[model samples]
Structures are given as C-alpha cells and as structure tokens.
Target: MAVVSLEGLSKRYGNHLAVDDVSFDVGDREVMGLLGPNGSGKTTILRTLTGYLRPTAGIVRVAGFDVVQEGRLARRRIGYVPEDAPLYPQMRVNEFLAFMGRLRGLDGQKLDVSLGLARKRLGLEDVGETIIGRLSRGYRQRVCLAQAVLHEPDLLVLDEPTNGLDPRQIIEFRTLIRSLAEHCAIVVSSHILAEIARLADRVAILLDGRLLAVRQVKASGSIRLRARTDLAPGIVSALRTAMAGVEIAEAPQAGGMVSLHVSTAEDGAVDQVIARLAAAGIGIVEMSEAGADLEETFLAVTSRKAFH
Candidate 1:
C-alpha cells in the first residue's frame, strides 16, 4: 500500500482555489518530489496532507487512515517540516527535541531512545546545549529534521527544507534525506528543479493550482548513445527488430553528431545496442545512462506566450 495517498484533493480559501484536484501517491521508502514555482500550491497541498488544512474537496489518506476522519492517527504516521522551521529561539537543541517528543506522546525509556537516536542521526550531539537561535541555518534545518523523525513516522514531509543553506549544506542535506528514505517514504516540496531531480525518485509538477505531470526522475534501464556518424535507416530498423520493447528516440544535439536515447524494459539492452552500432560501422563517441529531463518538462508545461 502507498504510504501517502491523495485522491482528487482540493483546497480553497474564500473564492480562491489554492489546490485543484491534485492527486498522487508516495510509496513506501520512495522519495516523491513536488516541483513548482512559488504560489503554485505546493505548500497548500502539503498543508492538506499534514492535516493542517482540511481539503475543500476529496480525500487524503496516510497509512490507510483518512486525514480528516482520523486526523490524529494519520498525523501520527506523518512527520512534517514546513517551509519555516518552527523553533523556540531560547530553547537548546536537546531541550527542543525533547519537548517535541513529549508532544508526540513519547515518554520514559521510549522518549530517551527516540531522542538519542534522533540526536545522533542528525549530528546534534555536539550542539546539544547550543541555543537554537545561535545555530547556523544549516544546523537549524537539521534540528527540524531530527524532531520530525523522533517517532520514526511512516511518512516524512519536507517543504523547501534547503531554502537558505549554502552549497555544501545542500549537498549534506541531500545525503541525509536519502539515508532517511531507506526506512520511510518522503515527500519533498521545492521549486528548485535541480534539487528535485537530485533528491526525488519521481516528481509531480504543479502549476496554477493544478497538477501538470508526474515523471520519473530516475529512468531505470535507459541509456544514451552518441555517435560521430549517423546510423543508416536500415540499421535503425534492424536495431528495433533485434530489441523488442526497446524505444529509440533522437535527443537534441549539436555539432552534427547523433544522440539517440534508448529505453528498454529488459536487462543488457546497453550491451545489445553497442554491439549493433559497432556492427553497423557507426563510430561511437559516447555512451552514458540518460538522466532526468525534469527541467525541460517543467518549462514545457509552465510556458506562457510572450507579451508584446
């Protein structure tokens, strides 16, 4: 079962519809990225998923519990870090995390274990006595993340978690997120395309309060072959016949070189393609796995006509 599910979820404020029929799911141990610009309802959808805002229409379920009908149960399975980290400036890191643990109904040995694990995982041991207000932006974000995972919820929700971090900090944050995904599903909402591409297994693009598309950021069993010479039409046809269920399409290229993207469901497709191209006397220049084209897709869907 999906860790988080949204079906025809919509949210409105007065006459303004903030989210329109947005639906998607985050599977167990999966990283689902929500990609869009500011004011595109990414935050609104997240708020609804966390049960902070009731959807104006449709349903949201987290771990088989309805977010509205069973808000407490559903929320217990979710650990959310909003765009802004909610921290008490005066409180120390350890104190704040302990307070959050108590609020989540943890106590005694259970709370102690949870706190110890969270602190160790987020590298907060050295900063345990440091005031939250005195910590750097990156460390503060880590604290927020630590608290969210205190109870080890089934689903983790993060909204613009790296907004103010430096490059090194962002890289470190990405590593931490990936490590967490080994145990639970994660939903990260961000307008930055590169971050989403690097962090998510799949991304759902939102625009103008509607879902534009959901695309896989990691293309499994896909490779790109660049040749100095173009393959003959016959060779292309022969390759298609040789590899059933393989899709070969030309990718945009420059300097008169040919770049073909080959995607297949079967293993060893790369070896097969290489062998055929060599047999056809095509001079292979480069062969690499195809990465995400999320930027292209995002631009295509969000494009608007130029004004005179």
Candidate 2:
C-alpha cells in the first residue's frame, strides 16, 4: 500500500517552474529516495508533501488524507523535518521535547511514554538536560528528528536529515532512519547519491522539475572486463569488426588503448575476444569483469547516448 502519493504535483513561482508535473508513490514501511542535483526541485516536492507550502497544481496526499484539503489531519499523521530545523535558542532539551510532545497533542503520562520512546529511539536519553543552543550540530540534528517523530506519525518526511552531520553521525542517522521503517513510511530527499543508494528501496529521479524515472535499487553483481596490454594491434578495429552494432558505452582512451564496458555473462566470450585481439596483433590493455556498479548504471542512464 502506498503511504505517500503525489499526482501531477507542480509548484511554480511567477514564471519559473520549480517543480513541474511530478508524480510518484512511496509504499508503506518502505524507504523511498527523492533524488536529484541541487535545485532539481527535490526540496519543493518535500515541502508540498509536508503541507508547509501549497502546490501550484496537483495533489499531495499522506496516508489517504489530502495534504492541502485535509492538511490538519494529514499533518497529524505525518512527521516533518525540514531542511533547517529551527529550534528555540534557550529552551532546555527536556523542555523542548515536552513542547514538541504537546504540539502533537501528547501530555502527562502519555507524553512521558511517547517522549521516552523517541529519546531512546534517537539515542537522546543521555542529553535530555542539555540546552538546545549548547548541543553540537550532530546532536542538534537529532533533536530536530526527535521532535518530528514525537507523535509517532505514520509517515516521516525528512529533507537532508544527514546534512551537517559527521561521518559517524551520518551512520547513526542512517540506522535511525532504517529503524523507523518498521512502523512508518519514510521519504528522504538528498543530493548525496551514494547515501540514498545505500538506504533506499526505491528511487525517484527528477530533473528540470520533471520526473525522469522511478526504479528499483538493483543489488545484483555485474561483470567488467579490461583488455590486457598484449592485445595485438588493431584490437579496436577487431572489436568493431567482430561485434558490429555493439556500442562502446565507456572507457577513456589513454595510452593508445580503447577500453569498453559490456554487459555479458559468458566467460568464453571474453576469452575469445582477447584471443582474437592477440591474433590480430592488437595490444590489449587491462581487462577484467566485476560487479555491476550502480553508479555506472546511473550515469549511463542519465548521460547522452553513447557515440559508437
């Protein structure tokens, strides 16, 4: 079941379209990545879903409640952590958490139990007495996250939650987000491609305010081959002659070598290519096959068509 859905969602400022005709769905108990470069309209979509800003057109829904039409209800069921989680400067950490709990209609023993749960979930039990202004940036980020989920909202929308965190903090944050998926749907937008790739079960890629593609994050290994230095002369010509219509996807031409990336599972095919190259007197540079790199797939899909 989809916990978060956007239908033809669009946001515009006068003549400039910040997000255009975007649509995607995030499933229940799943981590969905909203990814793009800076200003790729990723944040715009997050803001709309959070109901902080109304969309120029289309709808944002959370757990079946329309974000704009039923914002109060939708907001109650969703936790939001914006890019900069603005906290009061002087509020004591415990007091701040109480305030956050109250905002979610939690109080007394109920609030106490809920607050305790959030604190433990976020590893903030030890710092409960620290002032908001006195904590380090990493801890401050944790506080922000703590407040967002204080209500135990069914959905969590985080905009760059790992931003301003150290490497260790980032790891902790990742584990925290993963833990949330046990009971809530999560949608996180980040420019850190590898981080998202690591955590997300599905990905929605946007560009120029348009949805480029939505795809499953593949984990299967792949094969990569590098030509040995002894491949005879005219090896490039040999490859071209042997595999007509085969496209050279990538491999920088350097030191008089032409390397190429191919997706093949046959072992002898590679050996045959090398043997043929040697017979043709074409020098073969380094060659080996390895796991299918997702980064390579992402670039290849996003890049312009390769020139054969």
Candidate 3:
C-alpha cells in the first residue's frame, strides 16, 4: 500500500472549485513532486493533505490512516514545511527546534537525541546558538526543515522548500531531501520544474485544479542519435509520418554533428525510429540511450489547455 494516497480529492471555496478530482499515491521511499503554477491547486492539495483544510469530496490518507477521520494519526506521520517556513524571530535556532520537538511529545533523552540528529543532519551545529532573525535565509530554511523532521515523521511534505535559497543552498537542500528519502516518503510542492526534476522520483503535474499527468523521474526506452549530416526537411517529414507519435527534436551541437533526441510513446519504437531514419537516408553515426527531460514534458503538459 502507498504511504500517502489521495483518492478523488476535491475542494471548493463557495463557487470556486479549487481542486478537482485529484488523485495520486506516494509509496515508501518515494519522493513525489507536486507541480503547478500559482493558484493551480498545488497549495490546495498540500493543505488538504496536511489536514489544514477539509476536502469537499474524496479522501486523503497518510500511513494508511484517513486524514480527516484519523487526523492525529495521519498528522503524526507527516512533517510539513510551508512555503514561507515561518519561524519565531526572537528564539535561538536550537531553542526553536527544541520547542518544536517537545510540542510533538518528545522529551528528556529522546528529545535530546532528536535535536542532536536534526542539527547534524541539517548542518545546523554552527548556527545552533544564532537567533532565528539573525541567521541567513538558507540557515533559517534549514532550521525550518530541522523542526519539521525533529519528530522523525514517516512522511515529509515541503512546499517550495528552496524558494529563497541561493544556488549553492538550493543544491545542498536538494541533497538533504534526497538523503531523507532513504528513511521516508517525501512530497514536494513547487512551480519550479527544474528543481522538481532534481528532487522528485516521480512528478505529478496539476493545472487549473485538475491533475494533468503523472510521470516517472527517469526516462526509459528513449534514445539519442547523432548523424554526420543534417536531416533534410523531406527526411524529417517522412520519419514523422512513418513513426507516428514519436517525438524527435534536433539538439544543439558543436563541431557540425547533428544530434537528435528521440522518444516514442509506443513500445519497441527505438528500432522502428532507427529503421525509419536509415530508410530516409539519414546516417546514424552514433546512438545512445537518454532520459526524457522534465522541462520539455512540463511545458507540453501545461500548455495543452488554456488556463485563466
């Protein structure tokens, strides 16, 4: 069974349907990215998942417990960090983490161990004594994460986890989240496709309060090709007609080598693509397997339908 599951989830604000029949699941050890533009139901989904807002229809479950009916159990298994990661400005970093840990029912030796682990895991030891208001944005974000994971929840949910982070800090935070996957399932909500590509094992695209598609993070059965000569317009057209639904794009290349990225929705189409290219008189000088990038897929999915 999935550790986190949303079945036919929907929410409404008076006349507005904020989320519409959204459904997806995140298994143990999986990192699922929830992607959508602003007001596209991504925030609504997260809020519903965390039990902050009740669903107008359908159900949300965490660790097999229904979020609404078993709110305490479900919430206990989830650690959440919102987009802004609000923190107490006057409290010291260690103090705040300790306060959060105790609030979650940890105490004595166990609380100490949890605090120690959070400090080391998030690299907060150096800034433990620093006040929250004085810490850099990156360190403050880390503190927020530390508090979220202090109780060692079975699932972690982060909304725009790297929103205000510098490039280096973003990289570090991504690495930290990936490491956390070894211990629990994670759901990251973001509008940044590239960051989602880096952190998520799978991606769920949402648009206008509806789910568009769910895609695996790693591409399978895709191929990259290099040819000595540029593909003629006629050959390109012929290849497109011969292998319908196969996506082929000319990639930028240096040293005059023409590169083509090819992927097909149908099974066993790699050979068919190669044959079509050869039949079209385009010589395949090199061939290698490649992953389908999320950026292109994201654009294609979101652009499919116009949204207000």
User: In model 3, how large is the Cα lDDT of residue 58?
Assistant: 97
Evaluate all candidate structures by whole-model CA lDDT and list the values in order: 0.86, 0.77, 0.85
Per-residue lDDT value at 170 in model 3: 84
Comparison by lDDT, 1 against 2, better one: 1
Pairs that collide, model 3:
none
Candidate 1 has a TM-score of 0.76
RMSD to the hidden true structure, all candidates: 9.4, 11.8, 10.4
By TM-score rank, best first, the candidates go: 3, 1, 2
Candidate 2 per-residue lDDT over residues 1-308, each given as its tens digit: 57998999989989999998888888889889887888889899988898888999998889999998899999899888888887986998789989989978998899999899999988899999988899988888888889988998889998988888887677667778888888899999988876776568888877767777777866432324455434423455675677534334455556644556654332234444555566777654466544545566556656643111
The TM-scores, one per candidate, come to 0.76, 0.74, 0.76
* Model 2 local distance difference test score: 0.77
lDDT of 2 at 44: 90
Candidate 1 overall Cα lDDT vs. reference?
0.86
